[model samples]
Target chain A: MTPIHAPDVLISEVGPRDGLQSVSGTMSTAAKCLWIDALAAAGLREIEVASFVPPKLLPQMADAAQVVQHALRHTHITVMALVPNLRGAETALRSGARKITLPISASQAHCLANVRKTREDMVAELRAVVALRDAIAPGVPVEAAISTAFGCTLQGQVPEDDVLRLAVACAEAGASDVGLSDTTGMGNPAQTTRLFKRLFQEIGERTGAAHMHNTRGLGLANCLAAYEVGVRTFDSSLGGLGGCPYAPGASGNVVTEDLVFMFEAMGVSTGIDWPTLMAAREPLKAGLPGETLYGMTPEAGLPKGWRG
Target chain B: MTPIHAPDVLISEVGPRDGLQSVSGTMSTAAKCLWIDALAAAGLREIEVASFVPPKLLPQMADAAQVVQHALRHTHITVMALVPNLRGAETALRSGARKITLPISASQAHCLANVRKTREDMVAELRAVVALRDAIAPGVPVEAAISTAFGCTLQGQVPEDDVLRLAVACAEAGASDVGLSDTTGMGNPAQTTRLFKRLFQEIGERTGAAHMHNTRGLGLANCLAAYEVGVRTFDSSLGGLGGCPYAPGASGNVVTEDLVFMFEAMGVSTGIDWPTLMAAREPLKAGLPGETLYGMTPEAGLPKGWRG
Candidate 1:
């Protein structure tokens, strides 16, 4: 439990969702549930089990509803899923996800190039999704993940003003919280602190999870920068899964093991045990045999006398 | 250059000294020069070039004199060397090193275990070394690094009072600066911030670099916490080389390539280019073939269209 004075940091494992989405192989829904159970047993309070996008777009997530159903069995853990628009959000709600993340690209160029939607159009679509979620799961939380918040591959540098504007619109359009993502893994500590501070100050308490990439290896450091300024929730993929196809080796989200290691080792009480968290990696690697897994904690093991 | 009022973070590469001391292989003089040159080319301004300990203790650093001589060829970088006592300090002074670090283990157990000296005895030994450096190299900067600032494997739960007292003694004993180290890789972010804040407030401008270990995987996060509370310099090993023999995989220092990637990608201006930095990893790895290298940046390529 978080003390009123110093709230505990929330490490949300995105391995099952974001991690699997970018990989080549498909993990059976049962294997994913086992992985999710392992993560929750290790004390991860939230897990992004899968995304609700159409199977045609993401065949790996064909059984999103099944994964969500299994994840809901562990009532203590908050089950989250990614949704692109109204249809995906509707699917996620039906699958019993308590939280749905709508990825809204902050860069128009990236939104058009990747999602085939303009920034304004994405927000307009989100309004309907938010309405749909309210109708189905009235108390469910809706998050607008502002992808490419730091910079983008297609657009280069994402202007800070554009990020803030989208954040405001997301909140106004009914997103319960807004997140910042280094979709291309281009964030530095200085830029991270600047942008996150601006978002919190401008948007008040609506700032959400810090979705960072390990591409440039700044993922953990960038996350720390965000945490220093009041971001409690963090998104990380296991084994540093999902390399940016454009930047090979950069796709893994910040390795969940490493992030948990950082918080737990620092005596910050991340509620994760090094041994149990590390044990979860085996299932992840077993599910994706040929894919190269990235992370140092698993290979190096935890330092001696580390408390959970 | 950091913008006015923006946070300034320093990347102190300790590959040549702390890194090589632990590995079994002796790097060819040419490989050392190439690695140091490559690091400088990648915008790493401060690097610990070599240790001045006796060759019998660490044959890997046998080429310290030659390595330091070669590093001097690059006028833009700051070359530092580690010295165990006055003898090593004298050797470092003879080699034209402008910066010298004297390791003083804060944990009495680590001091006796690592340097074969008692805490009081080491402080007395350091006072003499400081005097020797002042007489031999008047203008050269000498820093006393207080190791095991957080916790110790040998003693466990190092008293914060011991760390603070050692910091005061080092400064009072003629040291130009004082630094803290988590030699056992047991530091946490909250403890890091509190310790740094206490040290800075007590010693003010005398605080120096943060030498951390990635053994438990919180090195970068601890560095971020220190930076938040006003620590400016950070020490990292190249290829994440160097760990305590007692702590398996604790041998890797926080990898220089990954640390640089973290800072640069955040647009924090490490001044290091990704390609050049990645290219440097080859020499580091080539020097020790069987030794496992740890780092996220080199394994994962930089994000696409990365500006720096």
Candidate 2:
């Protein structure tokens, strides 16, 4: 198969949303804004700034609206937010999120454990959220992220048919884009390529980012596999912040620095300045003291005379 | 390009020689044999048991001869040792090593720093080693490993032409096989595919293992790229041991457990039993107390239905 050599790939930063939500420490609204600013300065075009969940349920994201408002100041960067339901979608719209992502677990077991909803129930909620988004802010793009799309810890081997059926359902329900996520980091390169190629075939341009984890150390491999099969958009966390709590011993999301390095080294433009992106880690480390940050590119430094 | 679909891949474990050599702690000869036995039991057919360097230089490998002798007990497994020169090669042959690997740095600067010899000087030594091997034990295979073949830490951007030229020189010098190593871990998937494809074109079947590092977290990605280009043999360190001392902040070699996981998940047989391979880590950990061992597969555990 011909490898998809995109001129540039969009690296959507999900550390603030997916990362912070999983960690015990809560980054203050100001720290979140500073981190977002640093990320934007490093040439990131899109960032999932926060999740619109109830503060009581996820107190870490209590200042989601505030973080979103601050992020909106950088008009060039697309501010994205995670919305669980119509209520979350309404809050995200009010907060001026340019794009809202709704995570729908492809694995029924994971769906129940994570959101306490059945796959069918989540799809209905997605349709309602899509309708609400259209009614309130037609400009905002609503994306349905199929988490546990590859496989699941609670429920292994999420059928490809089920994943495709869900993707079709989400697209039919008015999702602007539907992305696949390796929630349990159970994806291999071959499986990733096959699944994503199918998704692209089934939904065409509605196919979105490949959200992989460094858990199994196949994050970059899986991403490369997806890239080879024509997937361009990737979701990563700064310093690999968010580990899947459900998947025990799994690492955080693929680190953005390392991801940029991989693409840039391969002559794929990510629009990210390597040194600047690396410099942003300082503020991130400051925000999460004693919290371990992981990325090999930063630790190994750049290759001699390298430029992004 | 058509991907190489090998039915079975050879995973040459390099932890004992490469890993223990770099780390500060010296695993006892008894411990080395036990670790090697555990590895062989896990179905690793080829293992670089020790490096025949001066004990004064590397106290960690002072018992190289003893380790090699012990390793040779496993007649079913190929006992390999690393030799720097003809003297080391002679010692390796006497110790009953089935195969001996001589590392010839592609980067002139790295060659000087590592072995205190120029590239040409090292090639001359390699020729002498090959002559010595043929004279003493024609049955024993002598491999010339082109270190920093991908890129260098001190002198970056080792030209592909330089790598090919060196490989030709080594092959002409009587090496049975010549392999490329990402010594500084400054390799990407694209570079890996291009270089290995060229190596296969120039040397044909003489092209050998892809020795990559997890330094920038592209180890498996680079390996996969090489695999796509028809390189089947892979060199990995169990527990991801052996970081490049010259390559600042570089992580250990590609974790064998993780590599096996990737290939097995893709239905590529490595002949290694997954659980048994993971169990091998216990003895390794016991040997190197307080020394950090790395491998995502061991940490993340096996996938739900994974067998070997």
Candidate 3:
């Protein structure tokens, strides 16, 4: 085994939860386990195995518990799951998720459209999840991922004040960590730096990962801005999956390969096996044949003499 | 006309020169002029109109003088051109190019391959071009674009020392400014920040634009790193033109549309009108009928209610 040491950055993989959920097809439980195994073998320290949502709503995550259990077997990898409310949180805890993310939209319109709840309702839901985590899984961290913190498709120009207010509300409501999500891919570098800086100022250590998208092609830049502002954890997907279903050709989350490549090239340690990470794509593609996978690094291949 | 004011950053369009040079097809002269007009109408302050290489070598730029002359008509825009040697520089000056860029590679192999000259020879060429400028075009600025400043496909991992030394050599040779170019798209954000920082340390205000590529999909992130280190001018293409022809689908230059969107969304004024910029893509597509055009902001459309 490789020597254990904290990496310069943590690129948390969300493909299983976010990528699979965004796609139309449901992968078999066996393929899911294999894909998760490949990612873990590639040295990913954290992997969001699945979202504990109703299988009727998102059939792709029907085997969330089994996926979580398989991922939990890799003690070195922190297993994560997404939850909507108390019930999902309870399921995630029972499945042995080490970390749980609760998506709470900063935009009222998006929150109402996404979960049939307003921002206030999301806050209440976050509180309920936090309480459930404390009682059932005391050590598991509950992350409030503030979606559409930059701008919204339903409403334009999400006020920075509202985002900060929601972040503070989440922290006060007992979230172990509060993160920003550019759910609509409308964030800019300045806004990212400003928001994250404010996050640190208000919530201190509770500031969490930056879940950015490449929809407008500023995903890496936004992540760089967050890193400059001291954000260590990042949420990305394999092959850049999970695009907004309504927006055609919209790149989903920032590609995990690209993000790790950036960090490694910058002389920052990511603790990932680059070749193994790239090879993991084979299982990813095999898991869901005929599904379109997107990533510049994989398509472009590695540059000549890339040590990674 | 909108009020004339300095934008926070200068995004110099390089499609007509770099874009056309890399593509196999030769766009008509009329198409070039019309595309330039569309870009000017979009409020880009500077645009590299053409490259003054011999027609036999690069037939796409055969109409360099005419293109430069046409772009010069827009008094508000600073028309620029690329040159490889003193002969090309002389032709560029005669064509009334307001600014000129001479691509000098920091990697010895790239320098030898690109210009059949060593880095030392390129420095001599820069000196000759500067001398000619002092005689024929006293006011025009000559930019020395240090391509492969970060890394090279031919000789991977271009030393940071070489890039800084070349920048100083150009500046001392009377070059107006020296810029860094990730021609091979092997640049990392940290390397970019480090190299640019060193360039500024050695040759303060003489530092110039960041000519980055999205070969590995970190173009915008690298640009952000340079911007963070006080770079204000950036070179990009309308449709991300001029990729390394050897590598298929390696995104060429940073897309001007996406780069402009990044700066604009950051509230850092690029002075580029958003809708007008998107509209400019129509002329670009028309100019190159069968040629592929690439950009995210163009395909994704504006996010709900973008002010630009």
Q: What CAPRI grade goes to candidate 2? A: medium
What lDDT would candidate 2 get against the real structure? 0.87
Candidate number with the higher TM-score (2 or 3): 3
Question: Which is better, 1 or 2, measured by DockQ?
Answer: 2
Candidate order by TM-score, decreasing, is 3, 2, 1
Q: Where does candidate 3 chain A have its weakest 10-residue lDDT segment?
A: A243-252
lDDT of 3 at B82: 95
What are the per-residue Cα lDDT tens digits for candidate 3 across B1-308? 13367788999999988898888878999999999999999999999989999999999999999999988899999999999999999999998999999999999999999899999999999999999999999999999999998788888888889889889999999889999999888888998899889888999999999999888888999999999899999999987877642133554699998888888777778888877888888887887877777778877877776773
| Alpha-carbon RMSD to native, per candidate | 3.6, 3.7, 2.1
Model 1: residue A14 alpha-carbon error in angstroms: 1.7
Off by over 4 Å in 2: A1-7, A243-251, B1-7, B243-251
Candidate 1 C-alpha error for residue A232, in Å: 1.7
B263, model 3: CA deviation in Å?
0.2
The candidate that wins on DockQ is: 3
List, residue by residue over B1-308, the lDDT tens digit for candidate 1.
32354335678899788887767677888888988998988778889999987888888787888888889888878889999888888988899887889999889988998889888887888889878877888888899999989888767788888899999988888788899998877787788898899899888898899887776556777777887788888899777777532134445477777666665554455656567777788887776677767665566556566654
Candidate 3 local Cα displacement, residue B277, angstroms: 1.5
- Best-fitting candidate, scored by TM-score: 3
TM-score of the second chain in candidate 1: 0.92
Candidates arranged by DockQ, highest first? 3, 2, 1
